[model samples]
Target: MLTLKYFFEPNVTINYPFEKGPLSPRFRGEHALRRYPTGEERCIACKLCEAICPAQAITIEAEEREDGSRRTTRYDIDMTKCIYCGFCQEACPVDAIVEGPNFEFSTETHEELLYDKEKLLENGDRWESEIAENLRSESLYR
Candidate 1:
């Protein structure tokens, strides 16, 4: 009876990497750092992201820039240690940090999982439109 039931069951698995799968609107995946419309970095070096990270995956160092603006000299996220609780983005006052839609960031080595400021910024640039749209939709409920 068990073998007969299995023989008639339809396959539920889809071809991934080609067919893809659906993701929720509020799905938290890779992280990114946003920028203002004026091309200035949105992060004020508030240390909120670092402080609020439950996994202690975030590390930040700030310095006064030449223009006297407080900027992060070093902002790194140890992705290996991240728990993806979405606390970092939620604690950000300026919405500088956001978790984007892309989740395909599989790395061959553990060292590659350490995300630096530049890499996060690059991710922001790459997924800005999607991130903004997600934020816009998310704000409607609040």
Candidate 2:
């Protein structure tokens, strides 16, 4: 009787490929490096994210540029090692490093999962709108 009632009810299964379910405001997904509206990279090379990552997935190397501004020369994240604890995002004071709403980053090889600065910047550019919206939504509840 109960089985028949549930079977006759409306279908609730998600067609994951064709349609995506609504993500929460605090949903942390793929990691990305954000840039300012002026097109400059937001990371000041503070290395705070690196320090906070419990999984030790994040690594950053900083250097002082000729113009006397601090910048990161090497920024890498090992996605395989990451626990997605969102600590790195919270540790970033400049909001340079953020976990955006993109969890479909499956790779064919393990080496491909080691994200470099350029790749992260590309992800930032690609998902800036969604990332910003997610951040805005997150702030509303705070």
Candidate 3:
């Protein structure tokens, strides 16, 4: 039988906790906010990403810093409303917002899916190296 033919073959099932399938170079998993090597945030608060989101999941408010430079005061993303269209990353002029290689952001409550500025910045710090590698591998604005 067709079902019996596979019985003699080796198991191909992956142990998910210990192994994971490779994501494509173009894969957009989760959002992150990047900072410069000097620890300064890269977003100019231009609101380009906010204007470009079809799902209206991204919200940002910018204010002038002490140096009279613009910076975001509040940046929030509702992950539940996101369409994963990758537009936010594309619309960023300074490459401040990016979709990192993280897909394991599941939470027990919906409230946890609402990401604030602090969470986004933390995500950037956590995944910066991986994000850079993904960008370089994809030849995307590296």
Candidate 4:
């Protein structure tokens, strides 16, 4: 008579919240509005992103400066409506907008997630280094 003996397996699962998995280079994540080196917003208020967005999550209102330079007076991106398609980043001619490697965007209210120009710019400033590093690291593989 043959007897089957099986040993209990140990828990091999990693602690996810503490030990997070690495993200791929192509991972499209939270959105940000970039700025120029001179501290001016990179967006020309062209509305290309608004038009190109399949979700229509982006809203842009433009106005001319005293020098006749166009800038976005009101730029809003509804995070609830965004699909993270990255089309907005691709549509931006001046690299004003980019998808950062941050997927931790969570809020208690929808209004908190609806990013305005100031909020987006702050995000860009905060995550600029990470975004640049990720881009550079990915460029090496390409």
The number of clashing residue pairs in each candidate reads: 0, 0, 0, 0
The number of the candidate with the highest TM-score is: 2
lDDT, model 2, position 74? 99
The deviation in Å at residue 61 for candidate 2 is: 0.8
After the best TM-score superposition of candidate 4, give how far the Cα of residue 128 lies from its true spot, in angstroms: 0.2
Better of 2 and 4 by lDDT: 2
Which stretches in model 2 have alpha-carbon errors above 4 Å? Answer: none
Q: Is candidate 3 or candidate 4 better by TM-score?
A: 3
Q: Could you tell which candidate, 1 or 3, scores higher by TM-score?
A: 3
Q: How would you encode candidate 2's per-residue C-alpha lDDT over 81-116 as one tens digit per residue?
A: 999999998888888999999989998999999999
Q: Backbone clash tally for model 2?
A: 0
lDDT of 1 at 111: 86
Give the TM-scores of the predictions, in the order they appear.
0.87, 0.93, 0.89, 0.84
Q: Cα lDDT of all candidates, in order?
A: 0.92, 0.94, 0.92, 0.87
How would the candidate models be sorted by TM-score, starting from the highest? 2, 3, 1, 4
Q: Candidate 4 — which residues are off by over 4 angstroms?
A: 1-13, 137-142
Error of 2 at 116 (Å): 0.3
Tens digit per residue, CA lDDT, model 1, 1-142 = 9989988998678888778778776889999999987878999999998998989999999999888889998999999999999999999999999899999999999989999999999999999989988999899764
Itemize residue pairs with steric clashes in candidate 2: none
Candidate 3 has an lDDT of: 0.92
- State the lDDT of candidate 4 residue by residue for 46-130, as single tens digits: 9999999999999999999999999999999999999999889878888788899889988898799889999999989988888
lDDT of 1 at 55: 94
